[model samples]
Target: MNETLIRWLEEREIADVRSRNLELAKAFAMVVKSTDQVFDLGCGTMSNFRYLDPLLSMNQNWIGVDHDPGMLRRSEPLVPRTRVQLREMNLATGVRTLPQGPGCAFTASAFLDLVSKEWIDQFAAHCKDSPILIAMSTAGQPEWSPIHELDEPIRLRIKSHQNSDHGFGPSLGADAACYLVDQLRHYGCRVIVRETNWILDSRDGTLLSMMIDGIERRVQSVQDPVDAQVWADRRRLELLKAELRLTVRHLDLLSIP
Candidate 1:
């Protein structure tokens, strides 16, 4: 993942309260019969563990995987050393190394959007017997409380950027949640999906600002750079004045074999 994206993930971990499907997560926890071994893919800073650990009733052993050694090191203090294990693995080429089987669960947060179809297929093949819970995959829609004229164009450009390769090949991006649901069902796994959109307002200014910057960067790469900058400026001003609110659509999925 890009360094900018890692920063954004840090901000998101703090601001992303709505994106966690607690009820579904609790349901997943209830089904665990033995030691809960959760393998969190792209586990930047172990934020997913921070969120789910409190909600789960059973004893958990988390194996957090990421290619970034810095991220692994940073997350070390967040989780108890006895309960958590960290692995430095690039998931794009390391799916074969993922742990699987009963008592194990696969999880990722705000991560599926960055992966390719082939990567997901390989992941599914490896974890065929494990339950999976994936959260916060983008759903390609941005709803602004006070609508702007440039919103649609900027959204289109961002969507285009999302579909571009992010090291795993052309990414499934916004369509990742639905695609995974279908793929898991084909494997005879029971799957459930829920909307987990991010609702941001004045109280979430920092995250809102980071979101605007990310959108502007993506938009600039594929569309008129000037327009993108101008739109970002206007949005930043609105954010500064506490006059902006945003609902970024996302999806969460739970699958059990």
Candidate 2:
């Protein structure tokens, strides 16, 4: 993966902290214990590690897995007091190789939405008996303040793009969290879900700008260039004037057997 993407993942952690559901984290923490092994899927640079390490029991072992060696290498320095072992693996197919059963937990942050339904089914079966916390899967279209007519059209384009293959075949995209919840329940796991929306304002200019740029890229192929540029420019102007507010809805899931 590119260094820029890794840096974005690191920076995004700040926003995610504010968005993460505390009650759901506490509930998941109650089931974990010292010395339990946790596998963090798609753990880019271990931002999830920093967020989860303190919440989990002391001395818990973590296996941070990602396909990118650069990200795993980047995660090395971020390790605080927890014992972390980084692994390079393609989670789309390698999830079945993860350990299961007692004294283990499964977790992933902002990952479920990128994977296909088949991959999720395999994941649900693998973690059926273990406690799992999957957080920050996008729930729906973002809410933008000072809404514009182009907002709806751009949003629809983004949705269409999200359903395309994201390295795991057809992505569940915005529907991932709900599908995972249903799948977990079918396996007899008690599941809890909470909103973890990213509410960005003027102070979040850099992150918000990056988000807008991403949206522009996603909509470029399907949306008219003139309309897309107009929308992007308007958003930039709003950010510059400190009048922009964006609420990106996400869901956090905690499942216990």
Best lDDT goes to which candidate?
Answer: 2
TM-score each candidate.
0.93, 0.95
Which segments of model 1 are wrong by more than 4 Å?
A: 1-6, 223-226
lDDT value for model 1: 0.83
lDDT of 2 by residue, 125-182 (tens): 8888999999999889888998999999888888877777889989999999999999
Clashing pairs in model 1? none
What lDDT does each candidate get? 0.83, 0.87
TM-score between candidate 2 and the true structure: 0.95
